[model samples]
Target: MRKSRAVMGNLLPFIIAIIFIFPIIWMLFVSLKPQGLGISNPLKWFLPPYTFTNYVHIIADFQVLRWLLNSLFVGIVTTIITLIVTSLAAFAISKINFQYKKFIFIFFLIGLMVPGEATLIPLYQIAQSMHILDSYIGLIVPGIASPLGVIVLKSFFDSVPKEVIESARMDGCSLFRIYYSIVLPLAKPALASIAIFTFIGSWNNFLWPYMITFSDHLYTLPVGIPVFNSNYSQDYILPMTVNAVSSIPLIIAFFFFEKQIVKGISFSGIKG
Candidate 1:
């Protein structure tokens, strides 16, 4: 019975993975279908004289490459800024004993519960007031100080031993030196996890970019692909093709960073 239970446990994840992955697999097949072949009929779905024209056309004519670059820029910038800010804030909250530390940490936690939609109007107004609308700054700045990133880093930072920090201080290391040298090196797994999560979040973000950017040049992949899809909806295969192409970066990111993500999340649960 124990052996059987182990086998069942191993099989369960594979089953769940297939269940989740089937839709993406189906979408890829559908995207490969020849133009003018509708997917309305189940039997006809795979009865395809497949072609690469959908992908070819999107790359050749649409702004997919540009949108992809925009997303990459935003994702990279947001991740960098988030890491810097959150690392500092997290170091302060986790390491430094200061007045109102608990209050400040609680304040950041409150930000996690507030929905983005609730702040949309205020954010929009602030963007307009700052005259940064339709610019990359508009897309990048607001996302830098994310509460989730702060919380994650703070948790990881808190797990660092107080003795090690004090030892470094006794050895005449500055706070920034300790943070830069000791704490950050120990927190590599968590940092990698946060970088991947932040980049993915920024890359996949549609709503904020949609609201902030007024020009086509500023549109990220999630925003641009949908508009392109709607414009070319008559060619049913095109939308699916765009979606498949857009998902490639995320797949590549996960393939490379999956180990770090798992390690980080696992290690984060350990008490200091």
Candidate 2:
């Protein structure tokens, strides 16, 4: 009975994973199908007779390429900006004993609990008032410091040994030197984790970009996919192909960084 139960437990997860993965599998299959195959009976969509036309169609579509570049720029910029700002802020909160420390930490922690949707209207108004509506700055400035990133790095920095800082200071090292040479180097795993989170969030962001980005030029992956899908509803396979192609970079990044990502999260919760 015990052996049977253990086998069942393992098999059960495999079955669940298959169920969850089926849609993406179906999408890839459909993507390989030609335009003629798109309008075929729903049941027949999975059969062979695949073509490369979907990918071809996207390549021929120049606007999609431009949109890809725009998103790439935004996502990369967002990741860099957030990583630097959050790392510095986390370093400060952990190292400096300033007035209102508890209150400030709590204030930022509250940002984590506040849903983005709830804050959208006010953010839009502020962006408009600041004359940054429909600009990349509009998207990036608001997203510079994530509450979770700060919290993650704060704990990681706290785990950093004070003796190291003292030793460096005894050698006449400045705060910046200590952060750059000692602390940030040791916290590489945590920083990588933060970079991945920020990149994925910015890459897949739809709602805020959709609201702020007035031109067709500004659509990111999530938003761009739907627009192209609607425009080419007769060829739904194209959008599926685009999505598959778009996810490739992220999937590859995760494959390589999975260990670092997990370790970062783990260390954030640990003392050393």
TM-score of each candidate?
0.83, 0.88
Best prediction by lDDT = 1
Which lDDT tens digits does candidate 2 get at residues 30-75?
7888774535477677887888877887777887887778778999
lDDT of 1 by residue, 1-272 (tens): 99999999999999999999888887788788877774567757666577888778778865887898899999999999888999899999999989999999899878767777899999899899999999999999998856777777788888889999999999999999999999999988788888887788898998999988879988999999878877885766778888988897788777888887666456445421
lDDT of model 2 at position 191: 87
Worst 10 residues of 2 by lDDT: 263-272
lDDT of 1: 0.85
In TM-score terms, candidate 2 sits at: 0.88
Q: Please name the candidate that would achieve the greatest TM-score relative to the true structure.
A: 2
- Deviation (Å) of 153 in candidate 1: 1.8
RMSD of 1: 4.0
Where model 1 places Cα greater than 4 Å from the true spot, the runs are: 1-19, 37-49, 259-272
Steric clash pairs (candidate 2)? none
Which runs in model 2 stand beyond 4 Å of their true positions?
Answer: 1-10, 38-47, 260-272
Every candidate's CA RMSD:
4.0, 3.1
